[model samples]
Target: MKFRKATSENVQAIVEMIADDPLGSKRENYTIPLPKTYYDAFERIDADPNQELIVVENDIGQVIAVFQMTFIPYLTYQGGIRAQIEGVRVHKDHRGLGIGKTIFHWAIQRAKERNAHVLQLTTDKKRPDAIRFYESLGFNASHEGMKMHF
Candidate 1:
């Protein structure tokens, strides 16, 4: 598998991956449903210097996974940067193949290259397996994450 920055052309595959997630059923509760237009905006935002959206491709050159990361600059941490990771999903067929680990390692490298002091992500508490997987990747369950819906 190979990982690279996502382009607008990869939108369809990305949307399919996202929609395949269990959480996708709650899209109506979120602000935006996955759509081609959202992908277009992602492409534009990711093109900026502070953002990155990545996709993992299989040997056949098909996009099989997708994630987005953003870098936030701050003066509070002695001029350090933080990377927030979101939208991580692997193709249903590709799970249990270590593709997720590969993509995550790629994201870590990318974050280091961007001089980010820390990397963070959140998973729903209900996903025990996913929480364990993230812990195996050296992430800590240190803080409570809250979201408000309007």
Candidate 2:
């Protein structure tokens, strides 16, 4: 498998894998010739030095997993940088092949390379399986995450 920053060609596959999940199915419009908004967002992320949209490809060069990482400069923690992981997804066919763990290992190493003091992510409480998988990767439920939909 290969991991790399995503390109325009990867946006569709990434959205498809994201929408395959329960919550993303409600929020993402995954379609042939996806909405321009998706491409626009990708462009913005691509231009930002602190943002990384990553994809994992199989041996034959098919995108099978994806995640977005953002590095934020914080005034707290001694003016440190925090890495946030989001939108992680693995194609349903490749779920049990340890791709998730491998992808996370890559993310963690990337965070360390960026000199981030901490790496954090929030998963919807409804996704118990996701929470368990994250815990297996050494994440702890140390804080209660709350959000208000706009």
Off by over 4 Å in 2: none
Tens-place lDDT digits, model 2, residues 1-150: 999899998888988998997788999899898999999999999999999999999999999999999999989999999999999999999999999999899999999999998999999889999899999999999998888989
TM-score of each: 0.88, 0.97
Cα-lDDT of candidate 1 = 0.83
Residue 95 shift from truth in candidate 1, angstroms: 0.5
Q: Which stretches of candidate 1 lie over 4 Å from their true place?
A: 28-36
Backbone clashes in model 2, listed as residue pairs: none
Q: Write the per-residue lDDT of candidate 1 for residues 1-150, one digit (tens) a residue.
A: 888888877776777777675677556222244445676687687768887888888889988898989999999799999999988999898899998888789889988999898999989888899899999999998998999989
Q: Whole-model Cα lDDT per candidate?
A: 0.83, 0.94
